[model samples]
Target chain A: MIVAEQKPFAEIAGFVADCNKILVAGCLGCVAVCLAGGEKETEILAAALRMHRRLQGKPLETVTYTATRQCDPEYVDAMADLVKDVDAVVSLACGVGVQYIAERYPDKWVVPALNTRFAGGSVAQGVWEERCGLCGECILHKTGGICPIIRCSKSLLNGPCGGSQYGKCEISKDVPCAWQLIYDRMKALGRLEWLLEYQPPKDWSKSRDGGPRKAVREDATI
Target chain B: MNLTTESRLEKLLKRGEFVVTAEIGPPQHASAHEIVHHARLLKGYVDATNITDCQTAVVRLSSFAAAVHILREGLEPIMQMTCRDRNRIAMQSDLLGAYSLGIRNLLCLTGDHQSFGNHPTAKNVHDLDSIQLINMVKRMRDDRVFACGEPIKEHEPRFFIGAAANPFADPFEFRVVRLEKKINAGAQFIQTQCIFDLERFSRFMEMVVERGLHERAYILAGLTPIKSIGAARYMQKNVPGMIVPEELVQRLRKAKDDGKNVADEGVDICVEFINKVRKIKGVAGVHIMAIAWEEIVPTIVQKAGLYPRPKAD
Candidate 1:
C-alpha cells in the first residue's frame, strides 16, 4: 500500500489562504488504511482550515468529500460537482490521487495535502514499515523471503557488510540489519549454502531507471 | 628488498615479510597538502598507505585523486573505493582512471551509511556490494573483460584487491566464514576493523587458521591510536562495528593522572598491539589508522621494529 502523512496544518492553511472556499479531498485507499488521509481526517482538516482562517481577519469555507479510490478516474470524476464552486482542491491522498484529481479537473488548482512516504503496510497500530523497492524483479525465493533491495541500508546483494553488529544496521540501532535477518532465516531453513553464491549487479533498467514504467494488459484492455 | 617489485605490499607479503600499512584520511577541504604531508611522514616507515573513500560517509577529497597526490610523494597508495557513492559504471570508470594515474592497489568496501555523514539526506547508490565489486575487479583483470564480460580492447586495470573485515561484529561465529567468502570472491588481502579486544581478535584469527584461509590471502590486523580519553569514549559509544576495551581507556586515564602525555600513551598501546598480533599465527601485518595523527605512525612502526620499509623499484 502507498503510505503517506498529512502536511502540517499551517502549511495546508497557507495553501488555501487566498481562496474564499476550497474542497478538501480524501482517499479510501492506502492513505485511509494508514490513518492519514481518510474521511475522518478530511473533515478534521476542513474544520481546522476554517477555524484557522476565521481567527484571522478573513473567513473561509470548505466542502469535504472522500473518494472510494482517488487514483481511479471514475472516483476522481465523482468530485466534479464538489469542485465546480471551490477555488482550489486540497487532495489528502497520495501523490497519485493529487495528480488524478488534477488530470480530471484540468483548470482547477489542485495541491497535495499529504506527502507520499512509501509502499508499505501498517506494522502495528499507527505504525508502518516499507516492504518493497518496486525494483521490477523479485528474488525472495533465494533470500528466504527477505527483501534486501529495500530493507538493507546499502541494498547489498551479498551482505551483512561488516556494519551488521548485534543484528542492527550501522545507520541506527532501531533499524534491524536486513542481511542479518536473511542470514538467520536462511540458517533456520538449512539454506545457508544459498548465501555462499554471489549475486551479480542488479539490472536497474527494469526499474524506474528505464523511465516512467507501464504494465500493459492487452488481453483485458477495452 | 625487492627493487623491481611493482606492488611492494603484495610482494612483501608473498615473501613472508611482516609488512605495515597506514591510512590517510583525505582533507574535507579541497587541498592535497594534508595527504602529501602524511605521505612524506610515513614514506620510510610503512609499506603503502590507504587513501580512504569518504571515511564515515563524510564528503572529502576523493580517494582516487588523493592516490595521485600520494604517488607524487614517491609512496605507493592502496586506493579505497566504496559502493555507497557509485554504481558499477562509475566504479569501473574510476578503476580505469585510478590505474591510469599509476595507482596499483585497490580496497573495495561497502561504505558507511550516508545518514552518518554531513549530508544526511543524500541518496546513496549501492548498486554493487563489496564481494561483487571484488569479483568484478578480478574479472576485469584476470579475464581481460569488463563486468559485463565484454573484452577490454585496451589496457585493463589490474589491481591488487583488498577487502575489510570486522571481527568484533555480531554473529561472531560467522565472521571467519565471511572472511573466507571474501577470499573466494578474489580478495588478495584482508584488513580488519580496529582491534582493541585482543582476546576476541585472537579467537577470530584461530578460526581463520583452522580453515587455512590465511594461506589463500594475506591478513592484516587494523590498529588505531586513541588521541585522548574523550575520543576513546566517543568511539565506544558511537562508532559502529568498533570495540574499544575499557582496559585501554583506563590506561590512558592513568597516564593523564601521572601527568604524562596521553597521546604518547596511545602510541605505546598501539605499539603493544602490533607486538601481540605479530606473534599470532596467520597474522601477516598491521594496518595502523592513526586518524588526524599520521605523524605518530613513524614512532609506532619504529617501536614495533617494522621501520626501514622494504624498497621497491
Candidate 2:
C-alpha cells in the first residue's frame, strides 16, 4: 500500500494564504488504512487550518470530504461540484489523488497536503515499513518471499551486500538485514540452494528505467 | 575511445603508486573561506581530496560547488554524489554540470538517511541506489547515453568513478563480494569506511585479494583518528556502520586518565595505522578522513611519510 503523511499545518495554511474558503479532500484507500489522509485526519486538519488562520487574523471557512478512493475517476468525479466552489483544495491523498483532483478540476487550485512516502505495509501500530520496491519485476518467489529490493540498502540482485551484520543493515541498527531474513527463511524451508543460484544484475528496464509505467489489461479495458 | 582522458587519481592508480587522499567537509554556511583554506591545505599532499556531499546527511554547500572551488585552488577534487537527495533526473544533470565545470572524479554513495540529518521530516528521494548510480554513470561515460538510453550529443561526463566500502559494516563475508560488484559496476577505486578494527579489516582485505578484486580496482584503506576518549566513546556507541575496536577506545581512555594530550595519541595511532595498512596486500592507498580535525592531516601525512605526492602527467 502507498503510505503518506500530512504536510505541516503552517505549510497547508500558506498554500491558500490569500483565500478564505478551503476544501480538505481525503482518500479512504491505502491512506485511510495508514491513518494519514483518512476522514478523521481530514477533519482534524481542516479544524487546525481554521484555527491557524484565525490566529493569523484571517478567519477561513473549510469543507471536509473523504472520497471512497481518490485514485478512481468515478470517486474523484463525485467531488467535482464541491471542488468548483472552493477557492483552493488541500488534497489529503497520495500524489496520485492530488493530481487526479487537479486534472478533474483544472480551474481550482489543488495542493497536496500529504507527502507520499514509500509503498509498504504496517510493521506495527503507527509504524509502516516499506515493503515492495515497486520495481516492475518481482523476485520474491526465489528469495524466500522477502523483497530485497526495498529492504537491502544496496539492493543487490544477489544476496545481501557486506553490511549485513547480526541480521541488521549497515545503514542503521533499526533496519533488519533483508538478506539475513532471506537466508534464515530459506534455511527453515531447506532451500539454501537459491543462494547458490546466482541472480544476475537486475534488468532495470522492467522497473522505472523507462518513463512512467502503465498496465492496460485487454479484459479490463473498454 | 573511453570517452575521456585520465584524471590525476586515475593516472596515479594506473602507475601502481601508493596514493594518499584526504577529505574536505564543506561548512554548512556559505562563507567560502573555510573551504578555500581546506583546499589549500590538501592541495599538494594527496592524489585527490574528496568533498563530501552533505556528509552525515546534514545539509551543506554543494559538493559540486566546493569541487569547482577546489579546482580553482589548483587541486583535484573527487565530487561525491549521494542517492539520498536526488532522483535520476537530478543526478544526471548534476553530473553533467559538474563535469562542465571541470570536475573529473566522482564518488557515488547511498547517503546517510534523512532522519539522521537536521531535516528529519524531509522526504527522501532515493531515485537510484549507489550501485545503480555507478552503472548509470558508467553508461553515460562509455555508452554515451543516460540511464534511460537517451544519447548525449556532446560532452558526455567521463569520470573516474569511486565508491565507498565499509568492511566494518556487517555480514563480514559479503563485504568482498559487494566490493566486487562495485568494481563490476565501474568503480575504478574504493575508499572504505573508517578503520579502527585492523584484524577485521585485514580479513575483509584478504577476501578482496582472494577474488583478485584489488588488482581490478584500487582499494584505499580508510583512517579516522580518535581525538579524545569522549570522541572515541561517541563513535563506538553512536556512529552507525562504523566499528571502533574496544581496545582503541580503552587506549584513548587510558591516555585521558594519565592527563596526557589524547589528541596526540590519536594521531600517533592513526600514523601507525597508515604505516601498517600501506603494507597490506592489494591495499593501494589510504584515505584519511580526519573530519573537523583537518589541521592534523599534514602532520599525519608527514609522519606516515606520504607527503610530496608524485606529479601526475
Give the best candidate by DockQ: 1
lDDT for residue A4 in candidate 2, whole number 0-100: 95
Candidate 1 chain B minimal-lDDT segment of 10 residues: B1-10
lDDT of 2 by residue, A1-222 (tens): 999988887788889999989899999999999999999999999999899889889999999999999999999999987787789999999999999999998888999999999999998999998999889989999989999888876565655643556778766788898988887788789987666554544666678766789988899887
- For model 2 the local lDDT of residue B108 reads 90
Model 2 docking category: incorrect
* Model 2 Cα lDDT, one tens digit per residue, B135-206: 889889999998788898787999999998989765565567667777888888999999999998999888
Clashing pairs in 2: A164-B170, A164-B171
- At residue A29, candidate 2 shows an lDDT of 97
Q: Model 1 captures what fraction of native contacts? A: 0.73
Across B191-252, the per-residue lDDT of candidate 1 in tens digits comes to 99999999999999999999999999999999999999999999888998888889989999
